[model samples]
Target: MPLGQPLRLGRHSVFPPLLMAPMLDITNRAFRTLVRGYGGCGLFYTEMLNARRLPTESAQSPFWQGLGVERDVMVQLLGDDPEALARSVERLLPLDPFGFDWNLGCARKKITHWGWGAALLENPQATARGLRALRQATDKPLTVKIRLPEHGHPDLFKSFIKLLENEGVDAITVHARTAADGFKRPARWDAIAQVKSWTKVPVIGNGDVQSAADAQAMFQKTGCDAVMIGRGAVGKPYLFKTIINQASGATEPAPEAAKVLEAMLTCLDTALETPKGAREFKVFCRYFAQTLPVPHWFWAPLQSMTLGPELAKRARVFFKK
Candidate 1:
């Protein structure tokens, strides 16, 4: 159960097999850097990009910013058109990501309204064709994030996943809920088990993993090759380090509030290095706020402050108290 094992995805191998799920607007460079620094995430993904927008420099440009060549990162793209997706992949090759992942399972209404995301799951044939086109476009690793189908026989879900394996997808990450279920319903970890039984590629289980024990139970119950952390890591990048230590049978000291405060400031400094970074710092503060155990007395004043230096000073005083 050591987290050092390598996970083979087609021709590539990722150590630890723990990926930071591609959360839109939350998994940017500063956040990713903070997670990696804590030590456990094997891969990080960019915010979802649009295939149609990839051709233009302005649209494609955001995906390329703040990423380092040394980091293991993938660009997750949302689109329904196979040709357009292929062209986008072609355009992205020069940027040299660790891989490319197709966003098939995002249940966002705005995304599906444009004929993308989890709506693609409703049409398995088109999803297969899109995966094939993207596979042909690049030799880099390709993965599809999927949600378990709602109101279906288990056999039907198996059939859909088989089609993805048949089409040469490198791996599949199952989010354990249908589009209809939204975030309200409990994630179907049983469905993840069913998908693992059906697929030959690496299966990654995602959803409702909030603790190291949950991470272990996911792997034990589903027999998945990996586990992907989403909202669970927000305000707690140390969650990764804790999980890794637990998996390895090592005892890790509880991260002190002071240490957590330092990590947050480091993330703020990293975010502020970009254009309009102070604005992004405010966004980051929203997530960091979740980690505070006390009442709003600290965050209320910090939120009102506009300057980065002022915010950092307030944060130091808050943590000291």
Candidate 2:
């Protein structure tokens, strides 16, 4: 087993340093709270905030709030404009995030159309300009998430990260898939070591880390400082805790799946409310229902059903003890 340890991000301590990757609709306040309840996640990221839209968002919305019980939240931003990205960082100061993450990795066409996300990689100097402005915006720890170039070109990758380090990036998460490859190919776990060798900044490995075993393999095989999980943890929020428990030679099983679902439902009801609650919950259930041990009927219509008395009623019955 690889050694599990704490990571320091600015002033925060990420013990058992497994992170929940920031996803478009998956990492909401309520779901994060439920995930934290199981114990083991180090730092959780908010949704990728559009820098252009950040200034217009209400702090009271779930989009900007922190977990009332924990402070280890990282706010992630994406935008093409250096000025807007910088401005959003300042606007987010009140949330008192653990740090900030620049999304250099999202490949969705919609995000890239605005010259945001992975599209920024097409112009290293432009990426640098935004990074410089972001560095000026906050003294808090800053990180960037990225995917390798289309062919995993060695010189181009190293040159790009060199720019990030020069701009004072605290950590870098490499998703390990080339932009064009998408999910059609398996993540090249071996390449993480190359990044580890090339960068002075800490490297957090991402992509295909679907289980605690995968996390351990990542550490042993790639020597990454941390592993980031997104879809894998959607159905099993106790994933980090399981990794921690197993690493310590503990044989404990995860919290009962039924109890986990109930807690998630409660958080959705009581935690901070957002105008997008319904939509967020739908996206969450899409990943969630497919992963549980429940029969097909338990999840069959969840994607189409509206959340209300119907959803609550079915959950109570489907997951009933």
Candidate 3:
């Protein structure tokens, strides 16, 4: 029944109760700052960073590129080593992050091969120990993003969530899919509802929330404290504004094409500061193109573009009409 209320994560207050989920290379500082311009989402997360490497990583590392001293930003770490995770959190304290998130839901082979992400779920005992260590190490609000197990074990999964709460974790974000299911299966909204029913801690529901209706449905169906949007916000930074507005009983206004292009240009300009900005521009256009009129046609030609100037030129022409 929480409607547009600030979501509390232990001592932290996530206003608006909407979040931009962390996506590797997608939620960079430039992109996040651009999205925030729309002014709806309450929290933003950084790309997954390796806890084991934080101690030795230089500021020039891609992990640190967009991560300045921002308290509203949550840096997510992936690793199963309690000591390393603790040490990494300690080293990261200087950044003054809003909180720390453990990536327990990443299903990629790159992360799983390191015994991180969803692999930790394979050994619930060790995962608990690591989380306990993380809680003992810092007073900052701690959260975890997790995926359910491949096979159904409703009781067991529920117990694991309770265990996380017992270990001093403040909040949980359920992606509503199994580790093995990846993105192929539809997110099980019922699973999120079950977790919400069981835990006193705040729960953030993520997965397949593409539009304002999808977000509203998640809130109504699960009664979750917050809704985290990922791929849905790709080209549409205004999606946040749309959802927040509709949640507050305002009618959703479709974003003007010019507004979408402007946001893309801003992202492009900011990303252009990076070394591989051209490549980044290409990848970003791949998504932003979807928001344009005749997206399929726009997206096809955009794939061949690499430089920002060329892309911007094409974008200006596309929106000029």
Give the per-residue lDDT of model 1 (tens digit) for 35-60: 88888888888878888878665633
Cα lDDT over the full model 1: 0.80
**Residue 65, candidate 2: how far off, in angstroms?**
2.8
lDDT of 1 at 252: 75
After superposition, the stretches of candidate 3 with alpha carbons farther than 4 Å from their true spots are 1-4, 267-270, 291-306, 314-321
Q: Model 1 off-target regions past 4 Å?
A: 1-5, 268-270, 273-280, 291-321
Writing each residue's lDDT as its tens digit, candidate 3 over 1-321 gives 225568998877888889999987677776787788877888999888898899788867766665555558888999999999998888888878888999998999988898889887677898898998889888988999998776547787888888888888889999999877777889999989999999999999999998888998999999899999988887687788888777677876677767766776775565664546656655655566564455566667777876667777776776665
Q: What is the lDDT of residue 274 in candidate 3?
A: 52
RMSD of each: 2.7, 2.3, 2.5
Number of backbone-clashing residue pairs for each candidate, in the order shown: 0, 0, 0
Best by lDDT: 3
In order of appearance, the predictions have TM-scores of: 0.88, 0.92, 0.89
Ten-residue region with minimum lDDT total, candidate 3: 286-295
User: How high is the lDDT of residue 18 in model 1?
Assistant: 82
| lDDT by residue for model 2 (1-321), tens | 745566656565577789999988779878888888988898899889889988877767567756344588888998878899888988878667788999998888888788788887777998999999999999898999998766546898889989989998889998988777788999998878888899888889998877888889998889888889888898788888888888888877666656876788888884413436766766766677666566777678765666444566667677664
- Give each model's whole-structure lDDT: 0.80, 0.81, 0.82
